[model samples]
Target: MNLLSFWIAHRADMLGAIAQHLTLTLVATIAAIAIAVPLGIVATRRPRLGTALLTFANIAQTVPSLAMFGFLVALPLLGGVGARSALLVLILYALLPIMRNTVAGIQGIDRAARDAGVALGMTPQQLLLQVELPLAMPTMVAGVRVAAVVGVGAATIAAAIGAGGLGDYIFRGLSMTEPTLILAGAVPAALLALAVDASLGWLERAMTPGAARSRRVTTRAMTVGGVVLLLIVMGGYAVSGRWGSRVIVGSKNFSEQVILGELLAQVIERTTDLSVERRLNLGGTFISDQALQSGAIDAYVEYTGTALTAIFHQPVLRDHVDVLERVTAAYAATGRAVLSPLGFNNTFAILIRAADAQRLNLTTISDAAPHTPGWKAAFGYEFLEREDGYKGLVRTYGLRFAGTPHVMDLTLSYRALAGGSVDLIAGEATSGLIKGLDLYMLEDDRRYFPPYHAIPVVRTETLAAHPELRTAIERLAGRISEEAMRQMNYDVDVSRRDVTVVAREFLDTVLQSP
Candidate 1:
C-alpha cells in the first residue's frame, strides 16, 4: 500500500508512536547535554578528572543497549518497565559523542586566542563565555547533532521497556511480515533524524563566525527551541501515567505475544470498567518477569516451557500437565498466579524452506542430519543460550552446521530463511509466518522438545487488588485451540490485519458462541 493509505489507516497510532519516539529521544538528548557538556568542559580544564570521566562514559557506551536497560531496571529508583529506565539508558548511550566533542572543541582552540584574551585583562569566565564559547559553538552543535541522530535510532529500542515509540510498529510489522507497517515506523524515524541533523546543521553554520547573516539564524533557533519544548511537554504526559490506571497488560516483543496481549487487553476492556494500559512490546521473558515482580506490569501471557526452563531454570519436563503444575508451583512462591492453560501449545520448531525440506525428504530432526554439515542455522539470541535450546538440540541430534550459527531476532530469522541467507531456523510452532513462508517444521522424534502451553501469569498483588480481573482473564481459558491461533496468526501476518481488530473479532465470535 502507498504511504498515504497506510497513514490514513493508522494515523492515530502512528502519530502517537512518533510523538513518543520524539519524547524519548529529546528527553534523553537534553539530559545527555546537561551531563556531558559540563563534564566535557571540566575535562578540558582538568586532565586527570577528564580522563576519569571519559573512561566512565566509555564504559557506559560499552554496555549493550538492552543489557544496560536491564541493568538499570534492577536498580532501586531506576528499576521499572517504563520511560524512566529507558530515558536513563538513552542518556548513557548518548554521553560519549557529546562529551568527547565538548572536550575536543575547547581543546582545539589556538593558544594565541587564549593569550590575547588574557592580555586584554579578561577574566577566565569572560574568556570562556565571550571568546572560547563562540569559537566552540559550532563543534558543540556538531556533537549534539550526532547524539541527536543516535538518540533517534536508539530510542526505537526503548519500546522494549514499554516505552512506546516507532519501534512498536517495527516490531509488530516484523512479526506480521508487513513491510508497510515497518516502513511506517522506520521512514518517519529516518526523516526525524535527518530533520534533526539538518536543523542542527543550519544552526551550526549560522553560529559560525564570519558567516553570512540574515534573520534565518534567529528563526531557526526559535524553531529548534519550540520543537524541544514540545517534546518535553509530551514527555511529561508519558511519565505521568496518562494511559490510565487500568490493568496493565504486558507482552514480549513478538507477534504471538502481541496477539495474546491484545486478546487479554480487549477482554478486560470488554468485561470490566477499568481501562487497560498496554505495556506491550516489552523485551524478553526475563524482562517481563522482572517487570511483573517489581509491579511495573500487572499481567502478561507466558508459555509453560519458557517459565519452566528459562525462568525457573529447571530441567525440561516430559508431560504437558506436569510442566504446567511445576511452573505454577514455582511461580506461587513468588506471589504470582499462573492461570489455567490457554489450550494451545506453541512449541519451538526447527524449520527450513518448504522446497528445501521436500527436496531433502526432511520431516524430522534426524531427517535433516545429513544436510546439517552444509547448512547454516539461524536462531534468536535467547535460543542460543537457553538450556533447552541450541546446545541440547545440537547435542541430541549430533548436528553440525557449515559455520557458527547466526544469532538474530526471531522475526529476522524468518526473513533470513525466506531470503535464503540461512538454510534453517528455529521458529515458534504457532507463528503465522511458519505457514505464510511455507516452511516445514522438523519434528522432534526423540521427544527432545517440551510442551509450551499458553497461559496467563499474573501478579498476586494485582489479583488481590482487583479479584474481578482473575475471573475476566480466566474466562479465556480453553477458548483458543492450536488451529484457531494459527489462523489468527495468519490473518495478522499474511493478511495484514490489525492485531487489535483480529483479537476483537476472535473474542467477539467466541463470546457470541454458545
Candidate 2:
C-alpha cells in the first residue's frame, strides 16, 4: 500500500500516535524551559557556574537517547516502564539546547540596558524581570523552539522503549519491509515538527518590542492552526475507539517477533472468538513490552536474555533452562506471565563470512577477536554500545584488531558479512538465512553469551481473566524447533511471504489438528 492509503486505512492509529508524540515532546520541552530559564539567569550572574552547567548538559547530549531511556527504565525512583522512562530520556535530550540558549540569551542582552535599570532604582531582581528577560525573550524562545523540534525527533526513538509515537508506523514499516508504512509515520512526524517550529517562531516574534501588531495576529493564527490540528488528532482517536471493531495487535520489529505475535493473534481470534487486528513490526523488545503495558498492544514475543539484561538488569547466563526459569519468575512478580518457550534458543551468535572463517581458521568469538583488531567488525546499533555487547566481549577476551568498527542494524550486518564488507558480526541468530548466505556460527566454547529462548509473554491480568489463553499460546511454544523457526524466518525474510498467512497456517497445523 502507498503512504496515503496506509494513512487512510490506519488513520486512527496514526492520530493516536501523533497525540502521544506531541504530548511527550511538549511536556519535556515545557519542563526543560522552566528548569533551564532559572538556571540560565543564575549562570548570567556567575559565569563559572554557567560553564559547569553547560558542561553537564553537553555531556548528557552525548549519551544516546535510547541508552538514556534504558538507563532510566532501570532506575527505581524515576523509572517504571512505558512513557515515564521515555519522557525522562526526552527531557534529558532537550536540556542542552534549552539550557545553553537560556544562558546565551541572558548574557547576550545589551549590558547598557541593565545599567539603565539599575540607575532607575531597580533591584537586581527587578532589573532581570523588567529589562534582561524581556530583551532576551526572543533568543530564549528560539532555544525553546529548537529544543521542541529536537524533542519531537528524539521522541520517535521513544517508540523503541514503548512510548507510542509516529515512530510506531516507521518501525513497523521497517520490520515488515513496507515503505508505505514507514511514510505513514515519517510524514506526520516531519509535519508535526514543522508545525511546532512555526508556531513557536510566531510566539517569539510576537513577544518582541516594536514588532508589528499584524505579525502578532499572524502568529496567533498559526498557533490556532496547530491547536486545531492537535484537536483533530485527539478526536480521531476517540472516534476510532468508539467505532473500530478491530483489536490492534503489535510486535517488535524483527522476523521472530512478527511471526510470534501474528501467530498469537491468529490463535486468539480463532480459538477465543475475538476479533483481531494486527499492528506488527513495532521496533525493539523494550518498545514492544512498553506498548503492551500502555495498552497500545495486547502482547508481543520477547526473549529471556532481553528480559534479564535489558529489562531486569540481571547478569547474563549460559544455561538455557536456568535463564528461562529466572526470567519467567522475575517477570511473573510484575504481574506478567511467560507462556511456554518455543523450545528454540536464538541466542546471540557471532558469524563470519565462510571465506574469512576458512582463511583464519577462526572457531569462536575469542579467536575472531584477535583478527578483529586488523579487520573491520560490524555490529547492530545496540550491540555496539551495550555494556554486555561487543565491546565488553572484546575487552573480556583481550583481543585486538587493526580496523575501525562500524554499527548497523542486525539485518544489515548479515548482508555486510555476506558481501565481504565486515570481518565479523557480533550478534546473529541461528537461522537459515545466515546459513543460506554461506556463513557459519563460531562455537562459543566458553559460553559467554546468555541463553535467549523464544517465549510468549502476556500480562497476568489477561491470563487471570482467560486461563484458556495460556494453553492456546503454550501449544505453539516449544513446538517450534530450531529448524521450524529457521524455515518460518526464511519464508518471511528471504522468500517474501506474508507473515500473517504463514502464522495462520502454522496455527492451524498446530492447534486445529488432532
Candidate 3:
C-alpha cells in the first residue's frame, strides 16, 4: 500500500503506537533527568564520587537492551513485564547521555565565571543557580536531546514486553518480510525523532543568551513543541487500553506464533463471550512463559519440544505422544495446561537459499555438512542454546561453519537468508518462508532434531475462572494439518494477508464444520 493509504487504513493503531512511543520516551527522559541531574551535580562537585557514579551508569549502558529487559522481568516488584519494566530499562539506557552531558556541561564552565559570581557576594547556591546553570543550559539540553532520541529507538524494543509501540509493526513486518509494514513503523518513528530533536534544538537555541532569533520563531517552536509533548502525555493514558474481564493472548515475535496467537484468540472470541486482548510480538520463550505464570497473559500457542526442553529442562524423546504427555504432566503442577497438539510438527530444519542448494547439490543436512566449514550459518537465540538446535546438529553431522554462527531473532534469520547475508539458517520446517522465499530445507537424515508438535497452552486458573474457555479452545485441537499451517503462514507472510483475516477465516471454515 502507498504511505497515505497505509496510514489511513491503520490510523488508529498507528496513533496509539506513536502515542505510546512518545509517552515511553518522555516519561523515561523526565525520570532520568530528575535522577541524573542531581547525580551529575554531585559528581561535578565531588570528583571522587564521579568515578563510581559514571561507572555504574556505564555498566547499565553496557547491558544489551533485550538482556536488560529480560533481567528486569525477573526482579521482584520493581521489575515485571509491561510498560513498568520497559520504562525502567529505557531510563537506565537514557541515563548515561543525560548524566555525562550534565557533568561535562558544568565542568566545562569557565573558572572565571564562578569566581566573578563569588566576588559579587553570591552564595554558593546562588552562583550555581544563576551563573553556572544558565551557562550550562545549552550543553545539558544537548544531553536531553541525545537521551530523547535514544529513548525513541529503545521504546521500540518495549513492544517485546507487551508495552505497545511502533516496534510492533517493524517486528511484524520483519517476520513477514514486508518492507512497507516495516516502513510504516520506521517512517513515523524517524519523523517523531526528528520532530523531537528539532524542537529540543529550538529550545536549546532559545536558552542561549546571545542566540539570535525572532519572537515569532520562538513562539512557533514553543507552541508546536508543547502540543507534541502534551499529545504524548495524554495519548499514553489513552493508548494503554484497559483489559478488564478479557483473555490476554500473547505470542513470540515471529510470523508463525503471531498467526497462531490470532488463531487462538479468534477461537476464544468466537466461541465465548469474553473479549480477547492480543499481546503479540512479545519477546522469546522466557518472556511469554513468565507472563503466563504471572497471569499477565491467559494463553498462547507453544511447541511441545520447546516446552519439554527449554521450559521443563528435559531430555529429548523420540516418541511424540510421550513427549506431549510428559510436558502436560509437568505443566499440571504449575497450574498450566498443555492442550492437545494442533496436528503439526513444526520441527527445526536447516535451510539454504534454493539456488544455493541446487548449485551445491545439497539435499540433506549430511550433504551440506561437508561444505559448512566454508559457509556462514545464522541461527536464532533459542536455536543457538537449545540441545536440538545448532550444538547437537553440528555435533551429529561433524560440521562447523567458517566462523561463529550469527545469532539473532528467529524471524530475522529468514530475512538474513533471503538477503544472501547468511549461507544457511536454522528455520522451522513449516515456515511459509521456506516456499515463499524459494529456500530448501536440508533433510535431517541423522535425526538429531526432536519433534516439535504445535499446541495451545493455557493457564489452568483462567480455565477455571471461565470454564467455557476450555470447551471453546479445545475445538481447535488436531485441526490444522502441517500442509494447512504452511499455507496459512504463506498466505500471511508471502501474500501479505492480515493475520486476523487468515485466522478468522480458518476458524469459520474448519472449526464450524460438522
Candidate 4:
C-alpha cells in the first residue's frame, strides 16, 4: 500500500499511538519540571547540594536507555512492563538538562539586580518570587524544551516494554521488514518532536523580559490551568477501555510472536465475551514472562525449548516430552501453567545466504565450520545470552570465526545476513524469511539444540477467574501446523499482509469442525 493508504487503514492505531506518545512525553516533562525547578531554586542557595544533585543527574545520564529499562524492570514497586517504569526512566533522563539550566539561569543573573531587590526593602522570599524567577524563566524554559524533545525520542524505547507509543510501529516494521510500517511510526515521531520543540521554544521566547506576548495567556493562573488540562488528558487516556471484561494478551518482540499473539487474542474474542487487549511486542522472553507472572498480562505464547533453557536455566534435553514436562512443572511452581503445544518445533536454525550455501556446497554446520574463520557473524540479543545459543553452538561445532558475533535484533538479523552485512545468524526453524530472503539453514548434524514446540503460557489464577479462557485456549491445541505458521509469518514478513487479516483467516480454519 502507498503511505497515504497505510495511514488511512491504520489511522485508529496511529492516532492511539500519537496520543500515547504525547501523554508519555508531556507527563514525564511535567514531572521533571516540578522536581527540578525546586531543586534548581534551592541549589542557588546551597552549592554543596547543587554539586551532589548535578553529580547524581550526570550519572543517570550515563546509563544506556535500554539497559536502564532492563535494570528497572527487575526492581520492586517502581518497576514493571508499563508506563510506571518507563516514566521513571524518562524522568531520570530529563533531570540533568532542566536542573542545570535552572542553576545557570539563576547564577548568571547580575549581582546588582539582587542587591537592588534587597535595597528596595523586599524580603529574601519576595526577592526570589518577584525578581529572580522572572529573570530566569526564559532560561529555565529552554531547559524544559530540551527535556521534552529528548523525552519524545526516548519514549520510543518504552514501547519495548508494552508502554504504547510510536515505537510500536517502528519495532513492528523492523520485525516484518516493511519500510512503510516503520515510516508510519517514525515520521509521526519526528513531527511530534518538532511540534514539541516549537511549542516550548515559543514559550521560552515569550517568557523573555522584552519579548511581546499576551499577558493574559502567560499569567500564573493560565499556566496552572494548562498543566491541569494536560493532567486531565493523561488521566482520561490511562483509564479509558482499560477496565471491564478484558484479557491483556502480550507477546515478545518478533513477527512470529505477534502473529501468535493475534491468534490467541482472536480465539479468546471468538469463544468468550471477554474483550482482548493486545499488549504485543513486549520485549523478549524474560519480559513477557515477568509480565505474565506478575499478572500484568493474562497470557502469551512461549516455546518448550525456550522455557527450559532460557527461563528454567536447565540443561538442554533432546527428548521433547521431557523438555515440555520439566518446563510445565517449573512454570507451575511459579503460579503459571503451560498449555498444549501448538504443533510446531521452531528450534534455532543456523542461517547463511542461500547463494553462498550453494557456491560453497555447505549442507551442514560442520561443512561451514572450516570456512568460518574469516567470517563475521551477527546474532540476536537473546541468542547471544540464551543457554542454547551462540556460545553453546560454537562450542559444540568447535567453530571459530574471525571475531565475536555482533549482537543484533532478531528480526533485523535475517536481513543483515541476506544483505551480506553478516555471514551468519541464528534464525527460527519456521521463519518465513528463510525462504523469502533466500537464506539456508545449515543442518544441525550433532543435534546440539533442543526441541522448541510453541505453547501458550498463562497465569493459573487467571484461568480460575475466567474459566472460558481455558476453553478458548484449548481450541487451538495442536491446531497450527508448522507450515500454516510459516505461511502466516510469510504473509506478514514477506507478503506484507497485516497481522490481523492473517490471524483472522488462520483462526477461522482452526475453529472449523472436522
Q: Which candidate leads in lDDT? A: 4
In the range 81-159, model 4's lDDT, one tens digit per residue, is 8888899999999999999999999998888999999999999999999989889888999999999999999999898
What C-alpha lDDT values do all the predictions have? 0.86, 0.75, 0.86, 0.88
lDDT of 2 by residue, 1-514 (tens): 4567667766666677777788889889888888888888878789899889889888989998767876765576677456788777778778888888778878888778888898999998898888888888888889899999999899887776556778766776676455666788888899989988988897888877788795669767967876886787677556535244445466776777778778888777777645555556556665567656655565667878878888788887777788888998998887788888878888888888888788888777777765666777787766775555776677677766556677777776777888888777875474656766788888876777787788787887767666777776777766777777888887876776656678877777788556
Per-residue lDDT, model 4, residue 284, is: 90
lDDT of 1 by residue, 1-514 (tens): 5767887876666666777888889889999999999999899999999999999999998888877777777687766778889899889888998999899999998899999999999999999998887888789989999999988998887777778888877766765667877888889899999988887787777777777563376576768778875875566445433565667889997878889999998888888876777778788898888889888788999999999999999998879989999999999999999998889999998999999988878899999988899999999989998988999999999999999999998987987998899999998888888888888899989888899999999999889989889888987999899898988988887777878889999999887776
Best by TM-score: 4
Candidate 2: residue 42 Cα off by (Å) = 2.8
All candidates in order of lDDT, best leading: 4, 1, 3, 2
In model 3, what lDDT does residue 260 have?
92
Q: Indicate the residue-level lDDT of 43 in model 3.
A: 91
- Over 196-237, each residue of candidate 3 has an lDDT whose tens digit, in order, gives 798788777776777656446777868877797787656644
Q: List the residue pairs that clash in candidate 1.
A: none
Model 2 has an lDDT value of 0.75
Report residue 423 deviation for candidate 2 (angstroms): 6.7
Q: Which ten residues in a row are the worst by lDDT in model 1? A: 233-242
Query: Whose lDDT is higher: candidate 2's or candidate 4's?
Result: 4
For every model shown, what is its TM-score relative to the native structure?
Answer: 0.86, 0.72, 0.85, 0.92
After superposition, the stretches of candidate 3 with alpha carbons farther than 4 Å from their true spots are 62-67, 70-80, 108-123, 210-240, 243-245, 351-378, 394-425, 439-447
